[model samples]
Target: MEHEDAVGRRVYGTDHDDPSPGPRPGRIYRELLGGPLDGQLFDVTDWMPEDLFTGALLLAPLGMYGPGGRADYGPHEDDPFGPWIWGGDTP
Candidate 1:
């Protein structure tokens, strides 16, 4: 993918001539939302299912919440994190 940023910065660009390698499956797990946990937190492991290796794969992280957690209907009022809803759409 090749594109310019908002400030006209030539960002990531991949050369088409370069030979690409085949897709490889791997596993990654994170404890907290942003950091490591001392004990067993939400452990998630991901791998390309056996049938999905023939093409490129886009992996997105999924999470599970415990009791008393607010359902993330939309962005928070205080904006603790970055913009939740992207694009021009509003909540």
Candidate 2:
């Protein structure tokens, strides 16, 4: 059997190409609903597609309350992956 190399686990699915279809910001600034709601998050959460939200939720780190951690992989370094993982600054 042939095995495939997996790098960066999936957030929503194995298909990494299916990026979110809309704006990825968690909050939106709106000016309409008077003072309190003005310049505040408009609660557009209900407007977002379920798949996109769920997929992002999966990608988020459960412990950190988010997955905003930064990961930089260098070509010449080896450890988490390997030097030969790629030939440039990124894989």
Candidate 3:
């Protein structure tokens, strides 16, 4: 299958934290989609020269950029790590 472009393609990621009822501590998962990886919780060891931002974005959340640019399935402070979307909204 042809992989989607890393830039806009959505990526779900989880930071290392203790698990909790709402959002696990170390397992704080979030979807990485759009914008740069400016607010990443973890370090992206590797990424293609051109795909650097793409890989970085995968490891972080959209909120890193800002509030308005955050993803619909937000991992933001208000809606952190939940309701992951694989293809559509039914997960």
Candidate 4:
């Protein structure tokens, strides 16, 4: 299986001497399918209510180059495990 790489390439805060802990438990990785953050892997592991997967979510567009907006995404209807489709954005 092909793995999806995260857009957050630079390691922040972690000490250079420490070894990577690897993937954490209870991590739910989902891909953002559109908008300025397209193809970005979003981790929705600790989202409340559990049904958050059934509704759209508003996320800050920090991943986009020179961000100044927000992106909205909804769960894909056909594939529950699929990428979240972009709904729109706000400036």
> Which candidate has the highest lDDT of all?
4
lDDT of 1 by residue, 1-91 (tens): 0111112211112123535311213422221122111111111234343422221111112213333222222222354222222112111
Off by over 4 Å in 2: 1-66, 77-91
lDDT of 3 by residue, 35-62 (tens): 3432223222332334322222122233
Error of 4 at 25 (Å): 7.2
Better of 1 and 3 by lDDT: 3
Determine which window of 10 residues in candidate 2 has minimal summed lDDT.
31-40
Clashes of 4: 0
Reference-based lDDT, each prediction: 0.22, 0.23, 0.29, 0.56
Q: Rank candidates, TM-score, best first.
A: 4, 3, 2, 1
Any idea what lDDT model 3 has? 0.29
Query: What is the lDDT ranking, best to worst?
Result: 4, 3, 2, 1
- Model 1 segments more than 4 A misplaced: 1-27, 33-39, 47-68, 71-91
Clashes of each: 0, 0, 11, 0
> Any runs in candidate 4 off by more than 4 Å, and if so which?
1-26, 54-68
Pairs with steric clashes in candidate 2? none
* Residue 83 in candidate 2, Cα distance off native in Å: 2.8
Give lDDT tens digits, candidate 2, residues 1-91: 0012222222222233555322234432111111111111112334444322221111222223335421221212233222211111111
